[model samples]
Target: MYDWTQDKAVRVLTRLASEGLQTDQIVDDIISHVDDFRYEAQMPTFYFLSGLTGNKKVASKVASLLQR
Candidate 1:
């Protein structure tokens, strides 16, 4: 069984980013959830944050989080 909740979050975040919505806060929220105990939750958050590496607004924050 899979946790759809995490998938839903990732999908929503991706959609929001694709639409040029409030991406900074979206990235920040994703970064904050990177340490989630659930692999389902953590991996998607990490992947999403990783995909934002080229985004200037949140790149440093994502890089800092990735370095930890």
Candidate 2:
């Protein structure tokens, strides 16, 4: 059987972004209401949406954009 919960979460986040929520807000919202996310894919989805602090290159890019 195919799982739909994870795909549902991704769609929710995508729709939220398309509706004009900023990236930081998206992460914050995801964290605050994490219970809405399916447990099976929570960790990976959280990290993918929230990002990698230890990734210097990606961090720098994000920071640079935020600075503008």
Candidate 3:
């Protein structure tokens, strides 16, 4: 499930970016989850990468998913 979690994290991060989430805030959030055994803490960081593409609503939805 590592790859899946990593992919999910990347997808969410892309969504967050489209939603206009600040880069620093996103970075901080991701970093904070480094030790998290839940929700693949790195997902937010993956989304923050420059090349990832996603929509604002999608990002928000991803964010909601992580919150769950």
Candidate 4:
């Protein structure tokens, strides 16, 4: 079974990095887990990235995805 504690850690770290609310450690975490995150974490990553950098494209993509 998936270990949600670890999974949640990955998500949290990725979000922190995306928000620029972190240092290199969170980025390292994101990079280290990138492969495993392809399925579940992609949307959260996009959400956090959009929130931090105000990327309209990412936001629009998420919006479109939700719209469907």
Candidate 5:
């Protein structure tokens, strides 16, 4: 029942990232929805991932996730 087509989820995540409020839970949530995103919307999700640099582990996970 998750509607990935909506931009609301990505926008909230991006806002959290832009504010330097990213957390492991947030990153995990993003990853959980990776496959749900449309092509155009993926870019903003990538932007959200890019903001999660405070944790090296999360950064590495994001790197590998993007490679897939």
Candidate 6:
């Protein structure tokens, strides 16, 4: 179930990225639900997305998200 959830997240992120929408916002929203992520699976993508945004608010949010 955990691995499956991670895969869904990756798929959703990929679709959102390809759509060329506000991916950073989508990433932030997903990170806020970090409990649904696996530490080594879906999370690294969120961390990278957060870093890519270069926004302090997003980075800080994801940092705390990772702590959970």
Q: What's the best-to-worst order under TM-score?
A: 1, 5, 6, 2, 4, 3
Better of 1 and 6 by lDDT: 1
Off by over 4 Å in 5: 1-5, 17-22, 65-68
Candidate that beats the other on TM-score, 2 or 5, i.e. the better one: 5
The reply for model 2, stretches above 4 Å from the true place, is 1-21, 50-68
List residue ranges in candidate 3 displaced over 4 A.
Answer: 1-6, 14-21, 38-68
Q: Write the per-residue lDDT of candidate 5 for residues 32-54, one digit (tens) a residue.
A: 77667777666667766676557
TM-score of 1: 0.59
The worst-scoring run of ten residues by lDDT in candidate 2 lies at 49-58
lDDT of the candidates, in the order given: 0.66, 0.54, 0.53, 0.55, 0.67, 0.61
Query: What TM-score goes with each of the models?
Result: 0.59, 0.39, 0.34, 0.39, 0.57, 0.46
TM-score between candidate 4 and the true structure: 0.39
Q: 68 in model 3: Cα distance from truth in Å?
A: 30
Candidate 4 per-residue lDDT, tens place, 1-68, comes to: 54445556655765766666763565545544554655556555654545445544445555775686
Residue 19 error, candidate 4, Å: 7.9
Ranking by lDDT: 5, 1, 6, 4, 2, 3
- Candidate 6 local lDDT, 36-64, one digit each (tens): 56666655566445444545655776677
Report the lDDT tens digits of candidate 3 across residue range 1-68: 55456656655765675577775566455545544534454454434543435434335545665696
Q: How accurate is candidate 3 locally (lDDT)?
A: 0.53
